[model samples]
Target: MDRTFTEHLLQWYDANRRDLPWRSNPEPYGVWISEIMAQQTQMERVVAYWRRWMERYPDLGSLAAASEEEVLKVWEGLGYYSRAKNIRKAAELILTDHAGVFPDEIKQIQALPGIGAYTAGAIASIAFNKVAPAVDANVLRVFARLLDIAEPVKAAKVKQEVEQAVLPLIPEKRPGDFNQALMEFGAMICSKRPDCDQCPMSQHCAAFANGTTGERPVLPRKRKAIHIEMATGVLVYNDKVLIQKRKPDDVWPGLWEFPGGCVEKGETPREALVREYMEEVELEIYPAEKITVVSYSYTKYRVTMHCYLCHSANNGQLKPVFNEAVTGQFVSPESLSSYAFPAGHRRLIECMLDEAWFDNLK
Candidate 1:
């Protein structure tokens, strides 16, 4: 079954393959970048981001030379900001430790920040043409059905079982293409709704023979989202609004946003904004008008941020003392787009623009 499965899958892959920009050349650096950006992101969206990122950074040297702020800006709207930071760190490590060359060995690549076992396997197989199994969501789904694993795919033990079963199927000469074919086959044919009739491996698939395709790859129950209410102030002085960079360890690290904190029990959003601003930045400003309310999700938290306009400065204390942020800046209304902001804060900016709120500040 294993040999026949391998032969059939490879033949099918040659006939039906995705024509991606990164696939044409498959350079080590380009493949690494594409793999990192593809995590938890849709392929269509990842294609555009990968193109923009490759154009901007070009190679490992340029990416290593870039500042965290610059990298974060380029990765804006990509959702996972830590991926940007991690790749930059990895790039710097490659330059310093390996003389700017991407590591060929899986162990060496895994030593880099944010490159886990799955990612390491992907890079080693796809970039270096090594015999490694890269098991992503797509591969896991395909494997669970092909091998007829009854346990939930999310379970660690089940994942290990799938990987072990797939290890021997990776061809020696074209291991990279083999891994990509498995990923593509999972994404296209053996998907959530597997087209059993069209699948080349249908005859070899244990789940199809047993009539348990849908139930083969058991999925875990979805977790409920936690709700959070937060408040922030847009304090303007001299036609500029004060913004703060979130602390490095905060939820939205390395991103700029209005200064605020979560609303405590018995406190209104307006009162929370004033108190949070005072406690966080030592800036005393009365919340004058409610500018915008934004709702966004991160991880499992569903956040609702109340943004207020603090048009006047109390006690003439314009200088900020940092607590919740690493640094604070008062930027012009027109320059807000220059900095990378959290999704909620970015939405606030869009809402203000739609309402022409910047004109009132001027």
Candidate 2:
């Protein structure tokens, strides 16, 4: 472990640290929220969401007691709905078993839902002032570059090696600040395309000396995108549009929105819509011209939605084709203001409705 490197990085962080909302007082609840929001998410976007989340559920108690639907709504556009669910579960556990007090011990914190080694270490150190090593992407990158390690960071063995290497360097006096300073340095100076000249550790960094700063922490290969096609019907009758409630176990579970399905290989968008509508909603649809398309992005995949206007030929007899949709209903376009749609669907509906498509139907 390089003692000088640690001191230099910490000094640089103290002088150049960004004034982020979560770092205000290092509250356990606030730190926990920020860490969760940052998992597989960027810092810039997490800032706004973190501020809004704190405003709504400032403490663990408020979040623990809130309904899942409400929590999902708050985390609507964020994607990875399971993170929000696990957060609630952790809060509930803290409220029930721990009496709403966050556990200070690393093992006890790690036992909570959604919390792993890094998260537990972070909470235990930064918030509870305990001696723990929090190794995340930034820490991994910093250490990998410092040691000139070429192993892919995703490999369990490589990650373990990196943790072992950096664990000895954590200052006994303030492990929390040490961890944050390293992470901040990796974020600002020793970035993916590192600026060696600006990095405080460049003087002794192994990767810098070897001229392989960008190549030390090799990342794993990315998976190919999964293509899914859904034929959908923007089923309309009179002034009302059709919607169905998703099953509690399904993705975007319990949310309400339009009818559609994956477009099969060689199937047209309208045909897929007809098949999906019949299979999922148990109704026949005559899809009109394309109305709108909504593109939603996530860490591993992206969905491009193509919606079309249609009239229900079956009139009143409608049953959900798949068990995931428990029930179906029709709401007037003007009256849809009261119903809650999935965030993506809401955006698509707004786009279609704003163009006066519903008005022309009358």
Candidate 1's error at 196, in angstroms?
A: 3.6
lDDT, candidate 2, equals: 0.80
TM-score of 1: 0.94
Q: What is the lDDT of residue 168 in candidate 2?
A: 81
Best by TM-score: 1
Which pairs of residues have clashing backbones in candidate 2? Answer: 229-262, 229-263, 230-261, 230-262, 230-263, 231-272, 231-273, 232-273, 280-321
lDDT of 2 by residue, 1-362 (tens): 57776787678878998888878799899999999898877889899999999999999989988898788777866767788889999999999999889889898999999999999999888898887788899888888888888888878987899788878888888788888887788788877888788666677788888988768788888888765544456777766678887887877776777888677788888888887877776678788678877777545666777888888767565544654486778778876665556666888778876898778663
> How well does each candidate superpose onto the true structure, as a TM-score?
0.94, 0.91
Q: Model 2 off-target regions past 4 Å?
A: 316-322, 332-346, 353-362
Give the number of the best model, judged by lDDT.
1
Model 1 residue 38 distance off true place after TM-score fit, in angstroms:
0.8
